[model samples]
Target: MNSNKDIWVFGDYRNYFQNRVTLQILARAVDLFSTTGSSVCAVVFGRDVDEYVAEYIAHGAQKVYVMDDPALNTYSIETYSWLMSHLVKLYKPETLLVGATRFGQEIAPRVAKKLKTGLTADCIDLELDEKGRLVQIAPSFGGNLIAKIITPVQRPQMATIRPGTFQELPHDYDAKGEVICLPVPEDLPKDAIRLITSERRPSEKQKIEDADIVICGGRGMGSKGKFKKLFELAELMNAEVGATRPVVYSEWASHDSLVGQAGKNIKPKILLSFGISGAIQHTSALMGADFIIAVNKNPNATMMKMADLAIVADANQMCLGIIKAIKEKIRT
Candidate 1:
């Protein structure tokens, strides 16, 4: 086994262009390298995936290991877990980071079990401890409190990080890195199940995490009828709608639009918060918003304090006024 420690990021290229979680995790691994003095590497398995390897290098990977074979063309949890466990045994990486996508959530735990190492899921942040162990920060007790956890005796500590938690580094065309091509192992396991065919449906709207402008509503919107106005405002402003947990539970919004520690993390350029009291669970997720405009009846609400511009007024009245103003502007 190699004596030097390495930080490995799983390269998920199924939606390379649209899903940027892999690049974001690679950027975070590079940042950790400064602290651990470990080599930053990416591992990928897919056919015709050379472009993704180059992209990873451009984004700060010091080295890339690729197994580009036709047999590995599509994603198979069985094949992936087997291959990943094999690689870890050979290279002995100190830490492994995977994106908390559906694919990753399935494969990471399997690999961790095969290696008998601890695995943390849906981590919001990661930092190294004084002993150089990876400290995983995740929500606990239904998102009320934050928990920091560590694996005391596990090799290649593993964690699945939420998407949008970290930003990716800028692409550098001039950057160079080593690419190690590996042949498929002769004993690669056959998948228990075979894929026949797959179909992808087009998305009808933008995901809340990727929105440039977000209009968020809380319980103070009074009633579901009043909350519906946020959708009107969103359409007029060309923005996406987000909701607090209480609003979602009240059936005013879908779970997809829920934003908080237990839900999606958004970093829109501009965020408009209405009637939210600024619970820690909700505010922590939107900390990355470039600018915030908050409206609430209580001037001392936590949300109001955190906003760049705070308005003390009835949320429904303010929402109606904004909608009317926008309509008049459109007429002129």
Candidate 2:
């Protein structure tokens, strides 16, 4: 494996229109592989993808491969997989990365099978070994251990990384990249999955998955009423609310708010955990936070041991006191 080859990122777009997580991953990939002399390229497919070429360049993509066609407006498993397979075959990149979103989960395995290559899913970290092979690290055996995966025989080492697992560099408007327009084949099988009209439901006020500041509660929250105070404090700070797995399973909060190995991984600027005994699984997922504050009745709890600020107190009263202090600061 030569270190001079390029690294490709699948710039997955949602319905050819909205949010894209690949740009963030691409930024991190650029930084990770920059010293190896491997430039980062992004592959985007859509109807009018020309409009997004500059966006990819701003995110540190050295080249943008655009596959524009009307048939690509909606996601078709067959079309997407075929297109990616073609790109992988054509470019022959040393490494390929895709976000482990729903769409990626659907397409990546299929592409890997088509290419007859190995893939590591839900990878948390990536690096290159002495042989210039990709070293993909992901949680394995229910988060009990970290596994380092490598594809020595595969032409392009493929991996699907979780969103929020990597930090993106600031967008540089003056960053430059080449845009290559690819042709989408006109003769393709009709999509088996039909897209009916889509509908949006009223979602929660704040989503823990995307929050910059998160306050989480756990089993030691005592009762549902006490757990609710976490949300009050979260609201006062205009932050998002989260919980450990036990809190969600016990019905103190919904499953979407759960954060841990079995739940969503969050990289907040500040993470505050109340009454939580941090299991290794939960702590591994949140150790990337810039700052962590843990409060528990037991001073020896795992969370208290690892937290920057550990407070031994009644969890409920401490949360209320913090909320009051925040409110007073806002008023003054």
Candidate maximizing lDDT: 1
The pairs that clash in candidate 1 are none
**For model 2, where is the 10-residue window of minimal lDDT?**
197-206
lDDT of 2 by residue, 212-272 (tens): 8998888888998788888777766767888888888888888888788888888889999
Q: Show the colliding residue pairs in model 2.
A: none
Per-model lDDT: 0.89, 0.81
* TM-scores for every candidate against the unseen true structure: 0.61, 0.58
Q: Which stretches of candidate 2 lie over 4 Å from their true place?
A: 1-4, 15-20, 199-332
Q: What lDDT does candidate 1 reach at residue 63?
A: 94
> Over 4 Å off in model 1, which ranges?
1-3, 204-332
lDDT of 1 at 25: 93
Candidate 1 differs from the real structure by a C-alpha RMSD in angstroms, to one decimal, of: 14.9
